[model samples]
Target chain A: MDELMEVLRRALPKVNWETDQALVDDGIIDSMDVVSVISEITDEYDIEIPSEEMEPENFNSVQAIYEMIQRLTEE
Target chain B: MQSIVEAVAAHARALPEKFCIADSRRELSYRGYWECISGYAAHLRDLGVGVGDRVVVRNGQNLDTVTAGLAIQLLGAVFVPVEKNAADTRILEIIEAVEACCYIAAKPMELSCPWEKLGDVLSFRDESADFETFPYPGGADTAEILFTTGTTGKSKGIELTHRNVVAVAENVIDGVEMKKDNVEVIPVPLSHSHGLRRYYGNMLNGSSVIILDGVIFYKKLFERMETFHATAMDLVPTALSALFRLSGDRLGDYRDQLEYVQLGSAPIPQQDREHLCRLLPNTRLYNFYGTTESGCSCILDFNAMKDKKNCIGRPTCNAHFIFTDEEGQKIEATEERPGFLACAGDMNMKGYYQSPQLNAETIRNGYIQTKDLSYMGEDGLIYMLGRQDDVIVTGGSKVAPDEIEDAAMQFPGIADCGCIPVDHPLLGKEPKLFVSMERGAAFDPAAIFQFLKDRLEAYKVPKQIEQMDEIPRTYNGKLQRKKLLELEAARAAERSES
Candidate 1:
């Protein structure tokens, strides 16, 4: 979970991954940021996030992203 | 000359039953579009939106926003469309700049200007009502005020007269050969001059435009295009990057169906241009170079000008260029000597609103000096060396970031790259490269620099390299080099503290 937080931090350094609950909702993170996160996680975790899985819900918060990653890895 | 507003009304009368615009929810025929425009105009007029009044509009690229724009124009009021999600400070700045008479948004927001929620504005509209009439505005009247922060750091409102708007649209029509049947899919914001002008060009030709906001649902967007039988698109380079990343070879699949694709807001790299040319050989791919100041000036057809580099093509039929030195003396850069690019035409802007000093410096004899280091080749096509402010002065020689980034884009496993200037202790300003790796591609500084060394001149080679999660770009997909420089500045400060 900390590792996922690190990846999120690296993707958008200006963003506060810890406390910012509505990352996507608040417009702190945009479509481009999501793309970067996808790329970074794919490179780090070696898991391919399919197009269908690239939803706003999966990336709105750190915990959501962590959960999504776990689901993909488990699969 | 028929103004853009008049053209819309004409299209309504001439092609009443033909398709006009479609958002996510519904589609409107030319007649239906006109009816809606008229309906909204009458309502706004009642709400005290008078002729020549400036109206701050929220542009979400929905049917209401687009319809209301025409309504504002119809009333002889100036339409000031801005991004929906723009910061409150920025919106306040614009309102104060124009002394805006009213602000129209998607929802009710407490504003300095007279506030009217778009839904409430449209509630009084009766679809069954007769056509509302107003005096069509003259060609010289200010129709739209587009705000841009380019050229100077501060925001400046660029006034586009009805004549200039018509000429800008016509230039695209002639350059891209837009037909009546072509349905252009516009995901870009309408507040932007590029997207708005593309809309005008389509409307002028009696075509259709579909508003798709972003690449969040781009796979569905591709499917929507297929559903609409979309034959045209006005896209930026970053959107192309996102789409390519999300779905490989999807756009290429629409080569036959799409008649033309107009690319603008930023210069495309040579390899990507050539790759697109090969992919969409039949599709007329136009890489246009223009600004809010000089509307849609240069357009290069990749299918025609294959294997070209740094070429922004020739000035459109309406525009004529004069390259000059720092002192603004006209010098035709027919080959090697790149000069400052200036353009003069009906398509050019009137002048920056209330900015006399900038107007004097930029606009001369109807020619607006574009701050780009450009040269007209012996082939008569204009080629950009770089933006004048962005040219890196390393040692004695000058290097354009476009050259570095374009070369790096061809480097193996590189998805995106930005070449930015960093403060060098000796050289004064030095080139540094920041890259984002492609899928499954890891950052390898040694291999990358080695590849760049062979391709670039020794001086042009970046002194330092770093991996960016993604290269930062404007919403329109132009490389935000200034942002990258700021990032470098912050890094330097951190280094000093540590």
Candidate 2:
């Protein structure tokens, strides 16, 4: 999860991650970015992010994306 | 009251034998054109179309379409012309939104409005022309309801009054220095301000208008231009670029005959303008800067292109422009800093029909906030940056898409490009470029990246590049960036699953 946050911080430095919701609503982190993020997450953590778990709501927030990666790895 | 009607009657009386509109099929003189419009006007009145009634006209660009427009105006009713080739859903949406009483379609088609065959309307050869003149609603009455894609969200009706239309026509004539003998080949969509203004402008000047079937077929367009001996023509950037590339040699044949080539609607790329000037050295090129809201704002002449390059030229007569900040305060022309472009003019539209929210956001006091960012140089020419909404901010740095796209297009093999923002974990956002290449050309993404890197700043370089078969465009040939973004998102999702 820390690794995921680190990668996210590198990719989106300007985003506060704690306060901003512009990623999903304003079409900043669209579905393509979701796939790329999931792929990068799996490679870094050595775990797979299932297709069903790729909903926009789950990956909308930084914390949510990290949690999803943890759940997928544990499963 | 009758003076407005007299304007049309005066044109008919003055130039009865003069060619009014010519299409592929036939040519109609001013006298014949008025007679047809009079018949259609009588037909519309019999069908209960009175003042303020919205009439939807759907037909290809032909003499009949021009007649339909004149007929609507002659009867003092609002003309809402839907693009003939518009998607059925889009057409229905417009009809439903406008609440049109009668729709004049070229053929029997399913539409929300009661579709009437154009043949049936025109076939009523009532030679007993009583010419029942209705009380002409001067400047205030809605002349046309032009539907422009709403920047606010949904498509809204732009209510243009008779005064607005006439003001625009006069502005085009004065700004372009249109002569009475200048024959203009109008190939733009009649639904748009470009087409309507050109048609009426030619009529106002007693000049001939050669209406092509549509603007899509470049070969046919050249043929028609030569056939009619067209001296002037108006084109959007895409059509102009396509014609420039397709008719490179053929254009030379008519180079001497052609007088002026007017471009508007979208930004004319610097390279494309240079190529056009090179091809037709004798012809003058003009770029018009205006919107459906304000009819004619600036006219960038051929000479201005050499020095100002992308500048939209000075404001036209009867129009004034000012750059405003976010807070609506005026910004002075200085060495640095560009501001939002605003217009104060007679050619401005009345307001969005039944849209108080949009009216409030767009028009404040007497000025229309164009939402287009621009700066005035020392030469007093206004250079438009891009739309305010099109600006992308990544890693605290704001980026304009036009600068990136313009730089990218300068590279070989690239035809058209659109830059959209993609979410980045560290950067907050990064530009994802979508490019369309010229036919029979192979694109190397690395070469493009290297080219962009050489031309632009490191931060402005596109993080990702996607090649598309063709760029999606609106009916008027303006790039649909939002649609491209959607396609990019969908493609990304599909790739993830694979």
Candidate 3:
């Protein structure tokens, strides 16, 4: 989780991807940011994040993103 | 007709029961739409709103918003629409800038009374009010004051006349091949000119419009389209890209029903364009290139010009474009020496609101010049090469960021990219690129540098390539190169501190 957060921090430099951060609702991450985050996460974790699974809930924070990756990996 | 409001009122009298505007929850017939406009206009009139007064209208994409806008115009007042969900501070700033007579919000705001509420206005509609006899200003009268997206304190209000709005709508109708029976689905912001003009044009042709708030509601959006049996839709590139992502391969299902799709306000990626073409093989896809100040200047028939996707096709409707050098000399269409793009026609704006200096600088001899640099190809199509301010002066040579960005987009693993000039001790300034890579792709700045080196001149190749999560853009999705520069500067400050 820390490693995932580190990756996000470096890629999305001005963003606060902490556990409490509301990435979408707070306007922290927009559609363009979502695109980049998805691409980076899938490549780094060797997981395929399908378009249907791309929802705001799954990516609202670093913790949320990490959990989503775990769920996709298990699937 | 002097204005769209008067024409729409006439249409209402002819066909009172025809559905003019519809959303998920409510629908307004032409008669009902006209009545609502009149009622609102009367209410505004009671509030001391009259001719030439600037009214700040902040409402999301909906039926009431459109009608309220029409009502304001009916009273000969200029409607200044701020983006829905804009912060109160931002709204206040714009209100101050325009010296708006009254502020109207879709929902309740923190501001006190005298600021009209849209919900209250909608509830007080006078169904018997006759709107046709209401005197509207002539063609040259200012109809709207559209504020283009800009950084704080630099927002320029574009004053568009009745003729300007109607001309752009007509240009869009012709360019997109819209018909009277066409049911156009509008999912973009109603505040902007593109979406507003598309609605106005359709209304002029007596066509029905379905308003969907956002593309985020994919299920509801598709359901609305199917329910309305929509034949056409208009959206900017960002919205279209998101739709493509959300729908994936399923977008092709509507190809038969959707006659055409208009995309503008930002550049569509070649990959996205090609994929969309495949998805809607029979549907006509257009790359509409125009400005808020200049309506529909150029429309590229992407279906026919598949080989020249980068080319913005010849001028549309009554518009005429010319490339002018620094000395204001018109450069002939010889496919060489790119220069500033200047436009002349009915589509051009009257001028910027309250800014005489800017009006003089931009509009010269009835020709409105844009900062965008372009060249007229031998094929007679216009090829844009980024903004004039985007040119990097390095080693006594000028390099356009569009060429570099386009070249970078072709390299594998890169999803989106932008290039900007960075100060250098040696060359004065050098080009540096910021890229947002494809998900799961490896970071290889060296590989990208080498790839660009192979294709471009040495000075054109970026000195540095940094991977970023996203590119800064305006609310309407225009690339904010100025914001990117600020971000780079902040990063440099952090680096020096470390």
Q: Which candidate is the best by DockQ?
A: 1
Native contacts present in candidate 2, fraction: 0.00
Please give me the DockQ of candidate 2 compared with the native complex: 0.01
Q: Identify the CAPRI category of the predicted complex in candidate 1.
A: incorrect
In model 1, residue pairs whose N, Cα or C atoms come closer than 3 Å (at least 3 residues apart or on different chains), thus clashing, are: none
lDDT string for model 3 (B309-392, tens) is 348887888698887887676876344467889999997999998899989989888888877778888787888866778888
Candidate 3 per-residue lDDT over residues A1-75, each given as its tens digit? 889987887667656566446665443454556767877887789988776675667777887888888888999
| Model 2: per-residue Cα lDDT over B177-286, one tens digit each | 89988889887777778877877777777788887644434555677787778999888787676566545556667788988878888876757867777778888788
User: After aligning candidate 1 to the native by TM-score, how far in Å is the CA of B422 from where it should be?
Assistant: 4.4
TM-score of each: 0.86, 0.79, 0.83
Sort the predicted structures by lDDT, highest score first.
1, 3, 2
Give the runs in model 3 whose Cα sits over 4 Å from its true position: A1-75, B110-113, B131-133, B151-153, B393-398, B423-430, B450-460, B487-498
Candidate 2 deviant stretches above 4 angstroms: A1-75, B1-6, B110-113, B120-122, B125-135, B149-152, B215-220, B302-304, B333-335, B393-398, B423-430, B457-459, B487-498
Model 1, B43: alpha-carbon shift in Å?
0.2
